[model samples]
Target: MTAPLARDTARERSRRRAARRNLRSALLFLSPWIIGFSVFTAWPLLYSAYLSLTDYDVIRDPRFVGLDNYAQLAQDPKVLQSLGNTAFYTLVQIPLYIVVTLALALLLNRAGQRAGLFRTLFFLPKMTPPVAVGILFLLLFNGQNGLVNGALRTVGITGPSWTTDPAWIKPGLILMSLWTVGSSVLILLAALQNVPTELYESARLDGAGFWRQSWSVTLPLISPALFFIVVVNTIAGLQTFDEAYTAFFGAGNTTYSNDAALFYVIYLFQQAFEFLHMGYASAMAWVLFALILVVTGIQLLVSRRLVYYEGGQR
Candidate 1:
């Protein structure tokens, strides 16, 4: 009995030793991610917050300017236009995206066709690099010999110079934006398919029609996902740079002519990199962060009236 007890104690000690070794190994394995996060994400975020409060160009020491940058943003006409442009873009894009995405999701959810082929076809636009797509769209909407104009000519109507004309540039870019709406459709389609079939079946027993079942059953179930897509796409639209900048060619004194195609970020980039105003750009980034937070909070608050959760009390 004594010998057996001694052996068991020895085994327990060995297990403890092995556990400590495994923990050490695990920590070693996780160190890379820990280091990367600290270096790339945490450090830069903290530094940027600090930079926002100072007026430091890259070549000089930063001077603490307090709220001067924020004050400037408030009074700047270009900033106001950019803000308005972004707001308009967000307002137009979010709903259009939601409608188009939901329509596609519903259509494809029951499409019964080979979903893989159709899904690939729709998602191809999303896969295209934004820069490439923007460049292609630039030509497609051109007034002369552009595909859109050619099509319009065929119909005995004229198309305006899309990129060159201020009146049509934003609209042309907005149309370009539609090409990537496919990604949202795919997201909504997933949400639609995730909805319980039993709910629709039960609703049918109550003499509900297709639209009725969808209104009460489908929409509610998918509301959570739709809500997420709305917020994300709104943020994306607010950060509209790649398409607008790539499609735009500031041929004259227009930094963001034709109604300020330079959305906040694009304008910020021009100020920071083009004009070498790092401190000001940093301030813009902070403002953008605040704006996004406020907008997102508003959405979440407003969503309470619209978004319905399953199996949980609101």
Candidate 2:
């Protein structure tokens, strides 16, 4: 009994030593991430939350106002307008982006030997910087001499002023947003390639036509990619800033920055930096964060019903 007890104790010590070594290695490897999160991410988030409850400007110390900023948000017309703009952008852009990307992916998937070249060509647009895209879009959508209007003139069609016209500003932004659909197309293309050939064969054998097979088999198989694109693009649409700002709110162009292009993030930026309303901006940021959380949660809930994972239970 004593001999067996000694052997078990030795084994236990060896296991404990191995666990300690593993833990030390893990901590060593994770130290950079831990430090980065604490310094940059976690600290900023906590500080912002605290700031949201105070009256803070860059030059002065924060004074506790205890939700005054949030209360004021209810009556702010700009806030409401910005939220509506963002919501409209999110609702319109996400579905259009998904549809366009999916269609491009389907086309590429059917391109046979030319698929790789087509994919590379399609993906090139995503590599273009957002600022550059915004500038390009501004030039393209210029009311008088822009390429879009120029083409319309050639066809004897009068194009609306896309940038200056309130009715067309959001539509112009949506059109600009479509330029970055390459990433979604690539994701869906990858998902499409992974879809089993056997499934397509089975689908065909059942007398299912191309559209019917695509509706049932292709869509279900690629639903995960679709869900990912929808969630990411919706969040991006809600936080739109760079494009609109670059196009309409450039330095010394305050007069051109109309209410129609006032996205939530752009408004928050104007509050924080331009107007020196740090606390109010912080509150707006938190509100935006909450909105994103709620939207993502709803999407997750809906996805459980809609998205499919092959060979796995729903």
Candidate 3:
């Protein structure tokens, strides 16, 4: 071969070698996540989709039934009731939690240096395990002698049976959730700090009241964080199984009080593990995914109008 031709061939070989090395490095970095996804998440999701199309109690071999589970879901009054309860809780808790947490952030933001300590105090609840939080709230809201009712009785206000009464159980859960406003507060606090000090100063110079300043300056700037917290908190509240599970143990048992806290996921768990209806649970899971996706899509579309982008659309 000529010397020039030999050099070109060597260069081509070098380029191919470099490309192969890059490909290997990329795969090496991705291997852990790829394995995890395949084993833990992907297989289960795909299998559940398959299961949703079948009739599989854990004991039996899965039977191929087309859409009966879904059709049954339509006629299932318990499913509808659980969905309604979850929706109601989401509607109430999402707004209340957002408003309260944002207000706390605003209060802390005004504090400046002391804000860190106050932030820590508020965020201590976030450090807690949800299971512990549930148990703690359970004790706090116990009917016969609870902290809330005890304090109320001292001042001549009688506290109702929070855990026992079906009418009052969900509200009690909402109240318990108020203690864990820490995550939202942190998100809000970050947004509050990012708001240009100039904006607030200018509003003050313009003789704008606190409300006016918040309306014109703070709210617009913090809208992104507000939207994020709203979305996350709504989803969290909707899938509120942990708290309800710990609070309303033995719900289907004979001794159980009014069936007040039969949350959707808890019911799903009961149907799947407790009742051994895997197919039914899989169908329930798909319906939930659809509901959440629909709600989220609507919110995303609506947020274009409601959530003000700081410098206006990017």
Residue 234, model 1: lDDT of 81
Off by over 4 Å in 2: 255-257
Writing each residue's lDDT as its tens digit, candidate 2 over 219-247 gives 99999999998888888888999888888
The alpha-carbon lDDT assigned to residue 120 of candidate 2 equals: 82
TM-score for each predicted model, relative to the true structure: 0.87, 0.97, 0.93
* Candidate 2 lDDT score at position 266: 92
Q: lDDT per residue, candidate 1, 1-314, as tens digits? A: 99999999999999999999999999999999999999999998888888778898888898999888888888888888888888877887778778888888888899756676788889898988887877788679877888999999999998888877766776778777889877788888898888888988898999999989989899888899999998998889889887777767433334334564668888888888788877788889889999999999999999998998877533
Q: Which clashing pairs does model 1 show?
A: none
Q: What tens digits encode model 3's per-residue C-alpha lDDT throughout 1-314?
A: 69999999999999999999999999999999999999999999999999999999988799999999999999999999889889988999998888899889989888998888888899898888877887787689888898999999999999998988888888999989999898789888999998888987898999999999999988988888999988888778778898778656644434436367877888898899988899999999999999889899998998998899856972
Clashes of each: 0, 0, 0
- Which residues of candidate 3, in runs, are more than 4 Å off? 1-16, 250-258
Candidate 1 stretches with Cα past 4 Å from truth are: 1-26, 249-259
